[model samples]
Target: MDQSISSLHMRKLCPNLEREDALDTVLEVPLPEEMFPNRKGGSSSSSTDQDNHYAWLKSQAFNKATDTPPPMLSGRTAELQLLLSVIGSPLIPMPVPFDTAFSNRSVCESSIQASTAKYILQQYIAATGGQAALTSVQSMYVVGKVRMSSSEFHMGNDNSSAAAAVPPSITRNGKSEIGGFVLWQKNPELWFFELIMAGCKMSAGCNGKLAWRQSCSEKSHASRGPPRPLRRSLQGLDPRSTANLFVDAVCIGEKIINDEECFILKLEVSPNVLKSRSASSFDIIRHTVWGYFSQRTGLLMQLEDSHLLRMKSGCSRISASTQISCKSINNDSSIFWETFMESIIDDYRYIDGINIAHNGRTVVTLFRYGEGSINHKRRLEECWTIEEADFNLHGLAMDSFLPPSDLKVDCD
Candidate 1:
């Protein structure tokens, strides 16, 4: 995706460059021999190079026996899984004095609402299955089915003619891939999640001290922030963990969701937390989450979150006067991308005295905007239905939660 985006930028920047020259400048590779073969005076060496290039391209496109997933589809699958894993996930916040007040009383009333949030959480705990029952559980296992679909994308920045000429790939109103996941969790930060869809697999887990994720498109990499809870926990699979997650959240008031009165608990990641997750070239500007708890049933009915990120990239500019002399243009300015996700939970079923949402739907939107790019948006939706669930699994162990040895662990 990055490479493709880079190519688009190059095309815009150097429209006058020949196609072969453009490929050479951007990809640092000669244009494909199929499209631009050597001419008349070409030597045997050039012919040999062409033959080798074609062979390499064929090899990349044709390995029938290998289990490696197709690059395009695999990349998309991995991307979808990454989006699902962090939909409404948040970082733990440091507690503040309840008596503290800010100049903007209405905007920063979290301190005053802390107690109310706690009381609401207690009610939630009691409603799910009292604290005693929740604390007694040490492990859990769940299996669920999901259907995911993505819509074709277009940028308003693109010309109307180009937009009209672009064939539709997929739409929000199109077919979806059906798949399922198996999840295992142990007390105090030990958990494993595996999702399989469209013949591609993605897995993530926590080994108490470290959290990591892996997929067909990428090697496993340790998470950036202090080990966060697995996204599955918020799906009503682990009431205890879910309760603890919002312990520091503030009651933002009540709202009617799906005809049911619900209390909204809101939590925003602190700047420090966002800083920890940011890379040198990318900044996580903001991440905020909200959970809607049913006032009548004291059950979680919906979860929503939004995140904003800014990334900076630099590209070189080639001069028409001297193709040999290239100048680095800070033209790679900062671009902001945002993602918003909302999940609606329903069909709650009692499993071992605990309320588990057997059916749910999640919709995610990714918006690309900021410097030099037109606002482009794409949407993905996933509906999940639980098929099986069991608590206190007997044989789940720390060994099963260990990060893969082949994975590279990011520095704290």
Candidate 2:
């Protein structure tokens, strides 16, 4: 008998004796391109054989390995492995270069900063569409579902075990409508909120002087009421006017981090601003990081936001981080022309040209305090597209409609 066959038979009979012949056979096989087909080409034999061999080898190695224990990983080691795996993965795309062909060393430092900020702002503006287009947008109707989760706090003697209990969860669906206008001698403005959340099922209008909200709940009769005075609510924040404000605010001094020059902007939330009804109930603290804009399109290529505060309790906090990029923008649309005309057709005098329409997706990662202790984090991963947007220059004025006599009024 051959020496290899005799050894194999002896190993099988003894069972306790470790098999060396099988190991030798695998080690002697050539692992070159000739033995394995090129992976780039579509081939079945190489991959199938490789998988089968690996599985067989792994099983055999573990079979008689009673004395050898599996490797144990510490928390830090596991984290490092995860980080390495993420960094090594091909799913993440490389960032676009920040330096532009128009970049010049001779440019003044201040001029460079201003030019860079302006270029970035323009890119963001153009990414949504040109400033002209954005300015013309008057009213936007958005119909989408919103998922909300709620948790009930539990009080117990056992602190550690109490924290381990699962929190109660609830979800709700809703939609929103937003309207924009020119205010304070034609300064651009914007206002929006969830219609259902406010407990009002009616339309609201503002014309700098007068403001109004009508309610049409099932319990209440259809009625048109006087506009609620939200001038104070309307005073400070205007998404359209603040577009440039955001650009300027984020155009802070530059610093080098990890050998890359980055512009860091600290966004602070004022208590006064928070107290205002216009502010959302949720906490939002935004710190934006900016890179140079593309010279050709004059749009921002990359933007990163750190420490996006969503909720805070005691010293514990929940936050999210985000990165946004504009892939493309289309300016020519016949549907836009039709929609713009139809919106202004009734009050032909008041409607203006379409100003801004944008569609994009954002990836958000939520984190909890105590190093992932609290489980209040979620991705809520969603993509939003702006389907219809129209801005009316002349405001529409509706005649007063009376409330129904048999309305069920809740005076609680």
Candidate 3:
């Protein structure tokens, strides 16, 4: 299962990007070779660089690997893992809120905060082409390019041993590696996502009942808790799904984003969902989301997702992002990791009567704390722009969103 989506394959799945009505944007989704540069002093080609690194890692090094993961072979590995933990398994607000709202429009009329959010959501729906246009859409295929990088984990105390485990090569300065992604969606619950970068790739999908994620380095694994829409879809790719996400949300306040005053609607992931995602390795503390809708445009300008989970005592393990779950010597006290992710959605332009967000940036910050006063902070970032979008595909089928056949239950 190579799982790489070629441009030709994408072109066949969706409408032409060069249509007479196409926007000015070229939406270049270049091949990986052109996307990620050589870490081998720019002499070897990307494929050669990748093959050489794979050889080096597999030769004698990978065979005698230690608990501490490799820092960086070149142009990235450690950072790739950080991405796999975050972007590879990204999730949006679930779509269950609509049931209560549609069943009874005044379901939560007693709460002012809830009522205010409903008002904001209505305006948002109208701004993104209204309920009529949104409902007409059945499926979508989105292609886009992205640049990503991660910062080294900074320790507040003298944790030299832990620092050694996280190699310095994993950190990028300002420049980041380029990558591309392809997403096919039938709805919030049924969708497929794939992203390739830095000689690493990841894919995840949900078949309306089960969700699973896989990467170049790891086996396919189930996502914990209830199924949720891909976070990328909410970056203005799917307005209907976004509206469904905030159906029962409450508007607490307003803020200015990108110089635009916006109303903020917030929602907390229910306790049942949190408990479902919990496992023997860790317990999810909270997963909250806040959407900022621009007052002038009435469209969502930004989204912020904050998540917290603590590793259970007596359990020693590391996550895809090794820095996120550093192994502790003492098992008596649990180590807590808080991840704050924010996406500033912008560059909205209509494609086939649907206003889709053409550009956006996502920033993820991770904080780790536990016994021995251990504290650390790390950041990962991604900037993406859509190249093309086609909706209501002719051959789109439910089989496309099926979970991997070899999917293993998530251990965390």
TM-score of 2: 0.34
Clashing pairs in 1: none
lDDT of each residue in 1-412, candidate 2, tens digit only: 0012111110001112366433211011111122111234321211111112111112112111123312222222222121111111101111111222123333354455555565555554554454666555443333222111112332323355334332221112112212111111122222222222111122333333233222222222211122222221111111233234334333556554334444443333334432321112123343332333334433332333333333212111111221212111111100000000000000011123322323222333333332222223322222233322234323322221223344322211
Expressed as tens digits, the lDDT of each residue in 136-178 for candidate 1 is 7888877677777766665555676435322342222434766
Indicate the worst ten consecutive residues by lDDT in candidate 3: 56-65
Best by lDDT: 3
The RMSD of every model to the true structure, in order and in angstroms, is 17.5, 28.8, 7.4
Per-candidate TM equals 0.70, 0.34, 0.80
Model 3 regions more than 4 Å off: 1-32, 36-75, 93-104, 158-165, 171-175, 315-332
Residue 124 accuracy (lDDT) in model 3: 88
Q: Model 2 Cα displacement at 194 (Å)?
A: 4.7
Model 2 regions more than 4 Å off: 1-115, 123-164, 168-187, 193-242, 250-296, 299-358, 370-376, 393-412
1-412: candidate 3 lDDT, tens digit per residue: 1233343122225245577454333243445465544545332212221222122222111110134333343434434655655754477745444323223377443498888888888888888887778878888888888888777657666656555544455433535777778898885468888777755667788888777777655667777777777889888998888888888788999899999999999999888888897776567889899999999999999999898876554323333443433344335356677889999999999987888899999999877776633467778898899987988776577777888777876445
Clashes of each: 0, 13, 1
